[model samples]
Target: MHYVKAKGILSAKNGMNLYRGCSHGCIYCDSRSKCYHMEHEFEDIEIKENAIELLEIALKHKRKKCMIGTGAMTDPYIPLEMELGHIRKAMALVCEYGHGFTVITKSSRILRDIDLLKKINDTTKCVVQMTMTTYDEELCRKIEPNVSTTRERFEVLKELHGAGIPAVVWLSPILPFINDTEENILGILDYCARAEVYGVICFGMGLTLRDGNREYFYRQLDRSFPGMKEKYIRKYGDQYMIESPNSRKLMALFHEICRQNEMLHDNAQIFAYLNTFEEKYAGRQLSIFDL
Candidate 1:
């Protein structure tokens, strides 16, 4: 791990990544793609030492309150977060300013901020989005490696539901023959249904692989799954979207399950839900008119 001073924190859209690299070690992480130009090792874990201060500044100057997002480019609750507490500090700032907040993550470590998430939601809105791909516990550990397994993430989703903090599940980067089977999809959907997830974001029934991530993925596949790399190269050489052979069938099952559960299966609608801030507490007032 290394610390570096960040020039700025929040992007124009109010999204901020407190860290530039991750230790979660997701095998199919898009953040590791060559197009992203990350010059260091993917697991080196770069810390933006000045991110909290910069975020505070950005929030204060903003004319109107909106949902502040994070955990897109890197997992906010990476192992280093337990030590640095950057994500916690950022959430504290958002709550202090009464700003809505949202995050997308793959780690169950996010449970630590459930209190703050509920607080922010009470004032405006706070939505927690989690990605769950593999239903088989062992497979999850193999791919995501260092992060929380899929079942643990499902438990987090259930806890969020019990907290009245609306949640979304990301069924993404389906990794073709590996986890794109009906059993895996249905098993995850069953968890989502039970958790009462408000949304499930699935762009397609496949994963995207390019340069950096592609090479890493191939290497791991050869080491773990064996012959899988050759299968991929033969089927999808140099292709960006390595779709599952069962794409159409799996997609149909995904939609039907989500629709039955009344979950937001549309990508655009789910994104809109995450970005829209509802002033649920807007009308609250101090009430002592007994003069």
Candidate 2:
């Protein structure tokens, strides 16, 4: 890892990525795609030196407190977090300042900050979003090599539910001819149901491919599942969306299951939930004694 002072921290929408690049080694990670234009290797993380201070300044000056998002570009609970404790520090700031927070990760390591997450949610909102692409533990391990398996993430979701923290599941990038099957979707949905997740976000039953990510993915495919790259090349020569043939059937099942379970399946609705924030300490003044 290397440190560099950031020019700014928060995005126009109040999202922040305290680090650049990742070490989780998800084979289908879009962040590693060429379009993102990272100057360093993907495994070599870039730490933002002044991220905490920048966040403090932005939050203090904001007229309204909305959900502060992270882990969109890179998972905040990467292995480095175990050593750095930066994400926990950020959570402490968010809780102390009374701001809502959300994170999208595939790591069970997020459990380390459960206390702060509950603190934020008790007053405002704190959503824990995790991705579950493959239900089978072995397959999940191969694809999301360095991160927690889907079962481990399921346990995290259940624990979050127990803490009264809402959880969202991303069931996406479902590689075609690999995991694009009825069993895969059903298994993940079963996990979501048992965990009592607030929602499940799925963009059909396939994954995307582009210049940088496509090449790297194909290389991994060749190494792990020999001759699969040829099948992909033969079928989706240069496509981006890459939806699976089973999308229609699987989507029918997806909507049906979510509808029955009362989980949020609408992408727009779920995004709104993640972006929405309520101030717990609004219009309250600190007493001189308390101050």
Q: Model 1, range 178-259, lDDT digits (tens) per residue?
A: 9989999999999999999998999899998888888888888987798989989889999998889999999999999998
In order, the Cα lDDT scores of the candidates are 0.89, 0.90
Per-candidate clash tally: 0, 0
Which 10-residue window in model 1 sums to the lowest lDDT?
Answer: 282-291
Candidate 2 lDDT by residue in tens digits, 19-110: 99999888898998888888899899999989999888888888987899999899999989999888888888888777899999999999
Query: Which runs of model 2 end up more than 4 angstroms from their true locations?
Result: 280-291
Q: Estimate each model's TM-score.
A: 0.95, 0.95
Residue 122, candidate 2: alpha-carbon lDDT: 81
Those runs of model 1 whose alpha carbons end farther than 4 Å from true positions after fitting are 282-291
